[model samples]
Target: MIQIPSKIQKIIGNEKYIIDNVGMSGSSVYVFEDKVLKIQAAGSESENEYLMMKWLQGKLLIPEVLAYEKDDSKSYLLMSRISGAMACDDYYMKAPELLTDLLAKAIHMLWEVDISDCPSIINLDKKLEMARYNVEHDLVDMENVQPDTFGGDGFKNPKELLEWLIENRPEEDLVLSHGDLCLPNIFFMGKDVSGFIDLGKICIADRYQDIALCYRSLSNNFKGIYGRAACEGLDTDKFFEKLDVKPDWKKIRYYILLDELF
Candidate 1:
């Protein structure tokens, strides 16, 4: 067990803690009664996540950062828990329509946040540079990636995908993006969006950044890919209709493919 620093230990005093092994943030989440303590490697994204959460305190529904500490080997961030269930809960999975509606509103909420004074800006050019670096350094994680992303139907490998993305980059429709907008990272209270979690990637980026990931997540979730309700033929158009934007499949595909590198 990783030792919780004294500051975070103080907040978690005598409170029974539960391990939260959800989401793909690569962090250890210790859930308490009304707080969450996330422990991750020192140089990982947790520090930036703390900064982003603090900066977004009033603009969006996000966890309130209470304490942050970093040592040579690990970083600890303690925050007030938001009241809600994950958007990927079994309840939402059974109702794809309502799920889509809430997710659409969540995307809109991210866009509506003022980026004039935003803390992070992860534009495509910067992302592409990082993609190239990841490829050169063999940093891409092959597991948990879209299976088709590299098989016979898709690109030959990560390098090919990165090259294709660079050549076919789409027009920018910038917004305050929830860098990783998968269902598990979004929360809801009833039918309303409650808060966002795993905000390490939150930044100013293309609007399609959120849309593409959410679309793929919805499609997979409804198809029982996560082993729940296998609702075939999910009419994903309802999502775009709710978003008030015509489906831009090209941009969507580009963004989805671009995400593979990260």
Candidate 2:
């Protein structure tokens, strides 16, 4: 059976109950009466999340941290309840037509956030080094790592792919990137996106890093939502074209593979 932290239970105090497990990591996220209490697995991720929430307080649509604590066995964060409509799941099921515009707006919002004041957020070079380390240490599952949309045979050598990425990386735009931007991370009410969540990976990076992942996610999850014939009608081809670069499939695959371990 899963254990709820005593401190977290105490904080919620008599609030009517429900517990929804939201993430796959070691952290345990429980949604009780709309509020969330996340208990990080001992030494894993509590500090980074605490700091991210502190820096992101008023700037983004994120849960406010109410309390934080760490003991020898675990660390926990109590946060304000997030009450909103569903995410991309219901949105695509109900009104698939709006996916394009919603995604466009999400991209715009990601690009617009100011990172000038963010401290301790990892920069692109560091992120690249981390990725390189993962590749070098055989941490990535190369066999299963392939582009989801534009299907390609898995790369024979991750080091070769990493070298290519390092040699031809796009000039960095240094925008604030969601780092893990995908449909599930976005919350929507009607066609408008209400907010974004799962902010632990937020960082400053090249604009292409964000765009590449977004493009791959949309292509993978909702390929049939917008039929091929509607390419012109939906104006999606134009939107993707304006992203101004082809996704480096190997690098995107490498990053996705690395994400699975983290």
What lDDT tens digits, residue by residue, belong to model 1 across residues 1-262? 4677797787778888899988665889988889988888776366668778889999999999999998888888888897889988888877777888899899999989889988788899988998899899998888868879998898999999998998998878789998889888999999899999988888899999999999999888877786576765457888899998898999888888888888
TM-score of model 1 vs. true structure: 0.95
> Where does candidate 1 stray beyond 4 Å?
227-229
Give the range of the ten consecutive residues with the poorest summed lDDT in model 2: 225-234
- Model 2 Cα lDDT, one tens digit per residue, 10-104: 77777765655545455676777767777766552467677877887877777788888877887777887765554446435345457766766
Q: TM-score per candidate, in order?
A: 0.95, 0.76
Q: How far does residue 42 in candidate 1 sit from its true spot (Å)? A: 2.4
Model 2: lDDT equals 0.63
Shift of residue 73 alpha carbon in model 1, Å: 2.3
Q: Residue 203 of candidate 1: its Cα lDDT?
A: 84
lDDT of each: 0.86, 0.63
